[model samples]
Target: MITVDTVCALIAKKLGSKATDLTLGADTAFDSVGLSSLQIADIVYTIEDDAEVELDPSQAANVKTVGDLVELVETTRAAGAAA
Candidate 1:
């Protein structure tokens, strides 16, 4: 039940920016917006908890945007449900 808007809001809150400041596009780079490793980890964990989906830590490290995080969680949830 996690929506893209919710994810974007989470990202904005985590980054300490207004949601309007982010484009929430697939190509937006996290580092470009000042997201550090610790912040990214915190956001990822929050998403994991909110979505109730476990993500691979290795793969999570490679996520670069709001869309990437959404895709990762959706895909991981799909794969888990399939299994």
Candidate 2:
């Protein structure tokens, strides 16, 4: 299941050492944590692979933090299941 911790871990993995102080703050900026386009792409790819579902980039465009990302994944998964 996609939990907040799971999302944090994924983001942290992508951030590498830059995530040392990662607190999973609800309003934490992705850019502030050094999540570049490549990292975002990697995170998206990893999530898609693990969940076996295609995530629409538009849905994730406004995501700004670990919490937001987790919510996005959960909502996307739920929507996919309904479809």
Candidate 3:
């Protein structure tokens, strides 16, 4: 299972910020890190690289926060395995 802590750590590494800036809770917004749209795309790419999973653009579009992203990744991974 992909834990929120692991997701936060990855986001921290990708954004070059401390994990302390992030929260595992649903209220934590990705934009709260002060990353731009381009940065967010790069973050998605980085997640794909590290997690070894390709994210659908549609699903990626739905991610607005760390928790939203974690859920997307988990669901997409499960669907990928089921296919």
Best by TM-score: 1
lDDT of each: 0.78, 0.75, 0.75
Question: What TM-score do all the candidates reach, one by one?
Answer: 0.80, 0.78, 0.74
Candidate 3, residues 1-83, lDDT tens digits: the string is 55667666666776674556555455568777766788788877877776778889998987998788878888888888999
Count of backbone collisions in candidate 1:
0
Give me candidate 2's TM-score against the actual structure.
0.78
- Please give the clash total of every predicted structure, in order: 0, 0, 0
lDDT by residue (1-83, candidate 2, tens digit) is 66667767888877778778768665666777777878877876787778777778887777777677777877888998898
Give each prediction's root-mean-square deviation over alpha carbons. Answer: 2.1, 1.9, 2.5
> Which candidate model has the greater lDDT, 1 or 3?
1
Give the C-alpha lDDT of model 3: 0.75
What is candidate 1's lDDT per residue for 1-83, written digit by digit as tens?
A: 56667766666787664555667655667777677788878878988998899999898988877778888999999999999
Which residue runs of candidate 1 sit more than 4 Å off their true CA positions?
17-22
Better-scoring candidate (TM-score), 1 or 3: 1
